[model samples]
Target: MLFTSSSSEKEILSIISKQLLLGSTDARHPFRFVNLCTLDGNQPDSRYVVLREFKEDLALFFYTDSRSEKVAQINKNPNAALLFYHPIERCQVKIGGKAQIITNTELIKEHWNNVQTEAKKGYQSVLAPKTAVSQPEEGWVQELKYQSKNFSIIKVRAKQIECLQLDDEGHLRIGFNKKQEVWQSTWLVP
Candidate 1:
């Protein structure tokens, strides 16, 4: 087996840290695109979002339009999940946490300035996301202005982490929970 039955908590966390680093720095990393899941009434809403930032404590950062439907869902319920997978590595990470939205702040301007011109256009949409447009051209903004007001930052502080690694020999699944600034990890069945 690739992993021993006695895998340490530190080792699991280290693996997670490496994956998070790859997600943020490597463009081709599979973890770069994560499925962000949020509650919409009693159902679930999920969408792919690029990973903007990662913190060791399992906090994640992503950008989206302030007027997006996901933002409204998050407002109603802060609980959320970020699911990531890397096919080549045969690894999957599920992070559960509370999402906090940041807008109208200096950080928003900083993030807006950092986004590429092409991507910044997403926030400049004439109408909010999920709005019906009569024509294709009517949906987008032709202006080059990078409006910070419409840029939103989502911060997710992870309360639980589930990581699964599949290999030819065996599959390993681990879970981590944070309490009082300490992390407790345990092995889970695949």
Candidate 2:
């Protein structure tokens, strides 16, 4: 079956808000994703990260070190892509946007202050992501604390979004593009 559904970028954006506010029933927020792509230094890089937060028509947040390569890559290339999926629901969401490193000290504190010790453990890694080094080992973290000062948040102001509905009947694609501060979506053959 070719399932067809479309919405204004803002409306579909609302769909995400509905999901995020629906308590733990929403698995989209926790899925590990591999979609932030960077073109820097002659080579493109990407990585998997937890989906942190989103504001309508504005920015999406994910945490990383100010010193990480991804951070540096974003500096070189602000364009990036985001992929979201649910195994049981069989739904996928794509977000394409220009990224800006969050620089507001207050915003950093607000986001960091909410980070629990467990979540903060991620920032304590000794090995920088995508770095090649000696034998890989774990448990070198000195401590687990909500230290947000050293971390930088990546904010993507989405310019386009492509939602793919994957099921038995091949797949269905929904495309949304942002123009003049408005979102437009169309059905495309998948």
Candidate 3:
């Protein structure tokens, strides 16, 4: 287990922050892909999103097409949840936050420039995501470009974070909440 009963809340938070930061840069990290849940009307919509960046202020960013359904959902309801789990470590982290579409032109350009050439096709598709097409290839662009207007970033500012670590002895859980720019943590029953 990464944490134990004797672990302090600060230590656990540090570990989680470190892991998340590492996940942002390491493609193979378990936290690299997260389950992002957003409200679609009264129902919950969940999908896997790559962890493109993690800020020290508890903000996480991911790339998506501007015309994707998720962008529409976030526009209607900004509240969202993110789930990260490592099967081998038997640890899970759940984050509740508010999501916003990043509109800063420079920020979007920076991220778009970093996207690999081969992966750029996803954003350069001729048709918007989820568009109906008779053939699968019809949805894709016939000619690839270095960039597309559909490239966008979604930022999630975490309000509450809960971590659970499974151990043979017993499970350990902790909760962290941010208010007024300060963070408060507490041990939770598991």
Query: In model 2, which residue pairs have backbone atoms overlapping below 3 Å?
Result: none
RMSD of 2: 3.7
- lDDT, candidate 2, 146-174, per-residue tens: 45645789888788877776767467777
Query: In terms of lDDT, which candidate is strongest?
Result: 3
Model 3 error, position 180 (Å): 1.1
Candidate 3, 1-190: lDDT as tens digits: 6678888888888888998998899999999999999999999999999999999998999999999999999999999999999887899999999999999999998888899988887788778889899988788653465565889999999999999999888888899999898989988898
Query: Higher-lDDT candidate among 2 and 3?
Result: 3
Estimated TM-score per prediction?
0.93, 0.78, 0.96
- Candidate 2, which segments miss by more than 4 Å at Cα? 1-13, 20-34, 125-146, 167-170
Q: Which stretches of candidate 3 lie over 4 Å from their true place?
A: none
lDDT for 105 in candidate 1 is 81
Residue 57, model 2: Cα distance from true site in angstroms = 2.1
In candidate 1, position 25 carries an lDDT of 74
lDDT of 2 at 69: 82
lDDT (CA) per prediction? 0.84, 0.68, 0.91
